[model samples]
Structures are given as C-alpha cells and as structure tokens.
Target: MRIRAAILAALLWVGPAAAQSDPAEAARHAAQLLEQAAEALNGAEGARDRVRALTEIIRAYEAGLAATRDGMRKAAIREAQLTAELRAREKEVSRLLGALQTIETTSPPLLMLHPSGPLGAARAGMMLADVTPALNARAQDLAKDLEDVRTLRQLQQAAADSLAEGLAGVQKARTELSKAIADRTDLPRRFTEDPIRTAILVSSTETLEAFASGLSEIAAGEIAATNADVSALKGQIELPAQGVVLRRAGEADAAGIRREGMILGTRPRAIVTSPTAATIRYRGPLLDLGNVVILEPQPDLLFVFSGLQEVYGEPGQVIPAGSPVGLMPGASPEIGAILSTSGEGTGTDRSETLYIEVREGGRPVNPEKWFRTDKDG
Candidate 1:
C-alpha cells in the first residue's frame, strides 16, 4: 500500500505496529493525525458553536503539523542510516549475489558431486543446507532495507502536500475564530470594565508592576463572586501555549536587561489558551508588551501572557480552562519553508515568542515553578 493509504488504514484500525517505535510507524501515526485534523476542519463549518469549533480545529492542526514534522525528521534519519548500512555492506552484498548466481546457473547433480567422493559430498550437502538459509536471509534483509528507504522518501515527499493543507486549514480556522470571538456574547462577567479608569491607570503606570497593581481600580461595578480555586493544581498546570522555553526567569537578554518572566519560542500564530479556569483581569496592549492577557485563576495569583498579535476575551470576564486567549504574532510559513526545514529537527521555525509571568500577591515569581516545563514543544 502507498503511504497515504496506509495512514488512512492506521487511523481506522489500531494495528499492532501502531504501538511500535519504528520510524515508519511513527510517520504513519503522524499522517493519521493530519488526516483527522483535515476532517475536523471540514466538520467545523457547520458547527453551531463556531468559536469552540474553530479553536479545536486550530489546535488539531497544530498537533498534526508538529507530529508530521517529527515523523519527517525520524524518517530522514532512518533513511540515512539504512543508506549508510547498505553502502557499508556493498562488498558482502556483491559476494552473496555472485554465490547465488553461481548456484542458480550450475546443474544440481554436478553441484552435488565432489572430487573427494561420497563422504565428502554428504558433508558438503550439510554445509550447504546451513549456508544457503543464511545467504537467503541476508538477501531478504537487504531487500527490505532498500524498500524501506523508498517508502521513507515517498512519505517525506507526500508530507509536503499534507503540511501545506494543514497550514492553510489552521489559518482559515484562526480567522474564523477571531470573527466568532468578536461576535460572541453571553460570556460570564465577573465585573464591568471602567475604560476611563483603565486609560488613566495606563497613562500613570511606568512599568508592568505598577500597571498590574492598579488592575482593580479599573473595575466599575460590583464584582461577581466565584469559588474556583486552583491552588491544588500548582506546579501541575500546563503551559498556556505550545512552545519551548527560550529564556528562563531572571535570564538576561542580549541587551543585558533581565526579566522576571520567561520567554517561550513558538511557531507563528500558535494558539494561546487559558491554563485553567480563570477571570480575565486585563487583556490588551500594555506597557510595550504588545497584546496581553492577564488571568487570575486564584485569589492573589495572576498569570500574565504577552506578545500576541490578536487578543481575545474582555476584561472582567470569567473563562473556562483551555479557552483560547490569543494567537502569537507572524504569518504561518509557506509550504516550501516547512518542507525545507522538516528534517532539520530544530526550533528555527518557531519565529515568535510569548512572555509568561506569574505573580503572587502582586510580586513577580518564577513561572517555571507554576507551570509544567518538562516538554520541549
């Protein structure tokens, strides 16, 4: 079967090889994920909750693309290994081929005859029985390796189209999600925003610390009450975005300016979500931080995310866990760029950064302590 067909089959059934660590199995799994994402995109158009549907679609695409990239990287490495092994065994392969060819061409009765007579012939026959199987097994292994190389090549080539399709689908989903969020109503609000007070505070604050300190001053009405407590989930909460840590808290940048927060390197337009159920304390451009979203998941605890191109939700609104907050800045890479870098297995493609800061009692704390930082993208 072709790579694409095999991927579809794997998706429909849990084959024994699906659980293996083989490169081919991994590639097949990746392809299956990409196909599922495509299906999600197709189903999203008719979904009643457009915002939710689009958010899921975008996430699906991201996961599928990431898996595909990993698969391609493994496939490339595996192919190179197979090629190198074949090259190293060239002499052995040639000798085996020559022996097999000689055996095929020689008459059976003549091959059985020996100059040393009947006893010698019987000994020769026993040796041939053992040796013939070894040669055939070696030949089978070599053929399988050659075939695998071809399959890996096809998989990589086929991935180019799947990656392009996934990229476009995600972009479209993001656009739709933005529109949906803009048109959305009925989200629960903890308090009404006082824009005049917010503007005054923005004008008066010189730093993020000062701005965050005065967040309560921007609330105009009586705040709604909530019993949500995420204190037990501390140090277990997932990162709000899919990316690897670029800089840790207190790490100095090239300009020698140290930050209290950590920077995450993410792919362009990666979706940022609420790590847990939280109330939006603030969301917008703040203090040269580009678009920002501040969440209060527990009393006196704040989670700040910045460097987004488009922010979602309104100030004082309560959002559920995994809610889409915003998207990272920059356009998605073109198909050519993706395919070219698929095998490099580096984060060079992650061109955007999201800054994350956790605050306890209005003081900046290390975000790594609050979030699970074990995964690298």
Candidate 2:
C-alpha cells in the first residue's frame, strides 16, 4: 500500500510541465521518495516505542536482582524470561533498521534521477536522521543493563560472604548484631501517628529540641499507667548506638546554631535500642532530623534519638532497655549531602551520626552522663 501511494503521488506530481529534462523528472521522484520515507518513519516510530518498553522491563528485572543469604530469589525463572525478551526485542530493532534501509538503497538509483546531483543524495542521507538518536539511546541503555548484570553478580557474592561471617559468629552476637535488631524489630504497636501530621507538627516548632518538647504531651492520659525511672539508671545505662562520640554536649550544630544533645558517629546499620524501659512518645521524620524518635522513660523525662534511617517501633509502644527500636541507615553520599545542607545532624563520610538528648523536668539535660559505655562519653 505504501509503494502504491508513492507511485500515485509521483504520477499526480508529473503535471503538464516539461517532461523532457531531468529536473522535472527529479521533482516527481522526490515526491515519491518523501511518501516512502514517511511510511518508513511511522513504522520505525512504533518499533521505537516497543523497544523503549522492553528496556524498562529489563531495568525492572535488574532492580530485583539482589544478592542475599539464601541466594537470588527466583533466579532461574527471571533470568530465562529476561533473556528471551531481550532476544525478541533485538530482532524487532534489527527489522526496523532493515525496513528503513529502503530510502538509502533505492533499486532505481536515487542519485541518477536527482536535480541537485550529489546534494539530493546527501539530503536522502538525512531521511532517517530523526530515528538515529532513539536507536543510539537504546544502544547506550543496553550497555548500562549489561553493567547492571555484573553489579548484581557482585552483590550476590557479597551477600554470600556476609552470610558465612554471620554463621561463624552466631554465638558471639553483640554490637554487630544490633543493626538487625534495630532495623527489623517486630513489636506490636501501642498506637500510630500519621507521618504527615507528625512532620507538620514538628515543622511548626523552632528547634528540634522544642519539637520534642511538644511530643511529651502526647498520650498524657497514659502518664498515670506507667512507671519508668531513667534518672535512677544514670551512669549505668547502655549506649543506644555503637560508635564514637563525634560532638559533645553544648557543641556548635552549624554556622551559629548551638546543639543541646551529644552526637555519636555510629557504624552503618548500627542497632538503635532504648537505653531504658520506656514508652514511645513519637516516631517519624521531623523538620531537620532525618528520622527521630521520642521516648518517655518516666514522667518529666524524655529521651530523644535522631538520624535513624528506619524505625521499627511506633508511638505509644513501651519497650524495655536493649530492645530494638530502629536502625541507623549508614550515611551515604546522597544522605551526607542532605545532612550538610539540612543542618539536621552532622554526618561522617562513612558512618552515620545519631543525636542523643535527655530532657528532664521540661529542660534539656546532658546525655553523656547517662551511659557507662565509652561510646557515649
């Protein structure tokens, strides 16, 4: 049908003008070439859309190709299906390129019947100019996916090595084991708050310390139902995070800002546990702190932990000391940049920082005095 349309258009273009010269004939031929070019362009466009979809599918499969202690999940089935789909997509792209070849290698010779001689041939070279970028981009994407496959293999190897280490140290679990406990606790929720509301309520306050002060009023009725004495555990409490103290109490937070809490640079995936048996006052992302949790160990005493990547406990939940509360997602390049600008908490290059504060009787108190471990001091 495309060929017939090209012929018909060329015939109509052959009017009552001089047909003796090559110029008149070339004009008619150009009309025919344009018709065929448009048809090829349309088909190639459809093929390009299909190839884009195929690339997206390949990337999705790559995303799930993580290494694990149990080995890659559904490895056999996913790999086979991805291979088959890639093969089919490659064929479609090849066919689309073949179909577009007609414009360049016309059997009657496109150059012979052209008015501008070599210039006409050069113009025909640009017939598929629009299609080149799409094809080139897809080619680049294929290369990236190839690299992703290699990365996924490396991840698998890493997971296997980690599993072996964990198995060897099964009986000696202590500090390193905290990350899992902090990150993956399955305690029942006493209550939950909307993250959006908690976020908004926190933003309305001046400082993070002030933001925490308001949370003490949450579940105020439950005050009569509990008994936890954090003051009694002073100088004997365990460190919540395992790391060195980066900033001591009364240190500068940013340019001109003063900090009320002590900042500790903890290892990645460091386990975050409650220092004392306490009831949760609030838990969620706050104004500057990436993720913050407020705990009420007793009336008029609030313990604050900030810079967590994930929190497993909910607001109003009561947990004992050394109980898993959350995980400090180790700071990466992305989060490090955010922390530098957000003025939330200082982050180290490789480790994450957690801001620890103790509020007693409506006032911020020194947190370093509570922990007996070398880490907090």
Candidate 3:
C-alpha cells in the first residue's frame, strides 16, 4: 500500500509532536501518589509508630503536591501552544476539510474524466493519485490536533479537583505532624534550656550574630557533648527545604538590604528539615527574623534557618538528619490561584521566602560552599 504508506506518513508527522511531553500522564502519576498518601494517613492513626508513619505520609503528600503543581503548569502551557497552533492553521484546516468533502462527494469516474482529452485525463488521474495521500495526511493531522485540544481541556478541568484534594491532604498531614512532634518526648536532649537566660539574651541581642554567639549562656547546666562531625560532608549537604535560591550570599534584596546568607523562595507551608544530624542550639522568635531554628551540626558550625510559621523540637535536643525543623509561613494557594497562575511562569507558586545562614566559628560563610546549590527547586 499506498494507503498504508500515507497512514505511516501521517503518523510520523504526529509522533514527534505528541512525544514532546505528556503532562496528563505526569498529573495522573501525581494524583495516584496523593491518593496513596491519603490512604496512608488513614492508617497512620492506628499505626504503632504513629510519628514515623505520619512523617512519611507528610513527605509523600509534599512530593505529590509539588509534582501535581508542575504537571498542571505544563499542561497549561501545552494547551496554550496547541490552541495557538490550531488558530494559526485555521484557514489551512478549513480548506483541507472543504477539499476532502468535495473529494468524498464527487464520483470517482467523474474525477478521472478530464474535459480536454485522453492525455489530459491521464495527467489528471496521476495528479489526483498524488494529491489524495497529502489530503489524507492533512485530514489525519487536523483530527489529531482537535483530539489533543479536547483531551487537554478535559485534563485541565480534572486537575482542579485533584489539586484541591491534594492541598487539603497535605495541610492535614502538616497539622498532624506538628501535634505529633509536640507530644514526642523520647528524643535525646543535649542540655536543658534556661528560659530566663534565653529571654535575657533575646532582649539584649540586636542581631542574629549576637544571639548565636551567646547561645552557650542560655543553657541551664553542663551540656552533654557528642563527637558528631559533618565536616566530611561540607559540600555534599542538601538544602534544608525545597526551594530555589532567590538571593545568594551577600546579594542585596529589593529593599537594598544585603546579608551574608542566602534567601530561598519556597512554596507556602513547605516543610523544612535538618540537612544533617544536628543539635538544636536555638529555636523560636529572635529580633525580626520570625521563627527560627539554629542547628549546630558540628561544634563550631551552625546552620540558621528563619521565616518559619511554626518550629519543631525544643532547644538543646539532638535530632536526626532530615527531621522536620519548621514550616514556611503563608497559606497554601487555592485552586483558583493555581489555575490562574499556571500559565504565567512567574514562579508565583514559590511565594514564601526562607533565610538561611551558615556560621563557621561564629562568622557567616557562603552557604553555597557548604550545601549543594546546583539543583533547581
């Protein structure tokens, strides 16, 4: 076949275009993960190790939500591209349909019979044979494009419900994790915090450096020491949160205020974790930096994270690596906001800012040197 060859050519034309990316497939996978997380959340209540189960569920929800957001954004883009292409080819498609309709309605005998002579008829038949395949290919392409537009529209409509469910699930998981952390009492403590001394230090300190330098004064008794050393992982440590670097070390912000640390742009209520096993040197409000968690992974090295709505764990407690430290401040975006911003590509999803500082021997250093900052959020 001629028909088979024409069909193959039509398929070849559509194959690369459809193979570019499948946002609907990605969204479906994310939706499945979110569904699994919801099921895990139900079972977590009755699990023997509720805290650990809840933590995994929360992490799953966070991952699923992030993927879902990305999928929706991509879907929006793909839909726009397809819509624009269809509009651009509107006249060509109309002509193609009209020609196809004429071919279909006209008798084959009439099409082959040219008016001029036998030679003209023979020439017309050869031309018709050549043009038929091209017309069929165009028709196939037009049909595929129309089908893709319909599928993308349907996917976008379904995405709203999925996003809403995922947002609610993640929020519930976060709340439960917070409560579980508060009730937890089995973690090893390095030292008991003196509230009076901490209050005094908070009042007296004007900058984060001063508060960090006086951390020792806030301890009530002899500090339980450990030989935990993460210097070997100096440049291998991951960032404590899922975000993109907004401002690098010593980069000035819009207000022209520069700090010796990095600013990360994170999604609202994104989970922040300890990059490595570290002791909680300090946690809570300090100066104007909002809720903060200062982790001392090594004796003289400290990782300071600020701009949290809620902080976990008490001061002077040794927490394991990847333990939840806090949550970024801001309400999660609603479904409407997500859909409206999906096509904007303005990074409105990452609306919260997290301030991170690495202090080595009580002096600020570029966090990029300590953490792997090459990957995008």
Inter-residue clash pairs, candidate 2: 178-271, 182-326
How high is each candidate's TM-score? Answer: 0.85, 0.45, 0.90
Model 2 — TM-score against the truth?
0.45
- Candidate 1 residue lDDT tens string, 1-377: 12234334433333334334677777677777767767776777777777766776676677677667666766777898999999999999999999989878999998889999999999998998999999899889999999999999998888888887777777778888888888889789899999999999988999999999988899997777777889888789988887889899999999999999999999888999999999999998888999889999988899999999989999998888878999999987666666564537466878899999999999999997789987656
Q: Which lDDT tens digits does candidate 2 get at residues 1-377?
A: 44334434433333223223233233234323443433433343234333222222211111111111112222222334455666768876575557546544766564345676777756755654766667667766766655545544454344344334332222123232333334434544445555655666676887766776666444424334555566777887866754567777898867856788888876555557777788888877777788888888888888889899877566867776656567678422332232132332233432678888888788888886776645221
lDDT values, one for every candidate = 0.82, 0.54, 0.82
Instruction: In angstroms, give how far residue 65 of model 3 lies from its true place.
Output: 1.9
Q: Where is model 3 more than 4 Å wrong at Cα?
A: 1-20, 46-49, 341-343
Ten-residue segment with the worst summed lDDT in candidate 3?
1-10
Q: Give the lDDT of residue 176 in candidate 1.
A: 82
Write candidate 3's Cα lDDT for 1-377 as tens digits.
22223223322322334335487776676677677777777777876655666666766776677767666676777888889999999999888889889989999788877789889999988887899899999889878987878887888898888888878887888888888888888889999999999999999999999999999999999888789899899788988887788899988888998999999998898889899999999999999999999999989999999999989999989988878999898988778777664346576788999999999999999998799987666
lDDT of 2 at 96: 54
Top candidate, metric TM-score: 3
The alpha-carbon lDDT assigned to residue 79 of candidate 3 equals 80
Local lDDT at 52 for model 3: 60
Cα deviation of 241, candidate 1, in Å: 1.0
Order by TM-score, highest first? 3, 1, 2
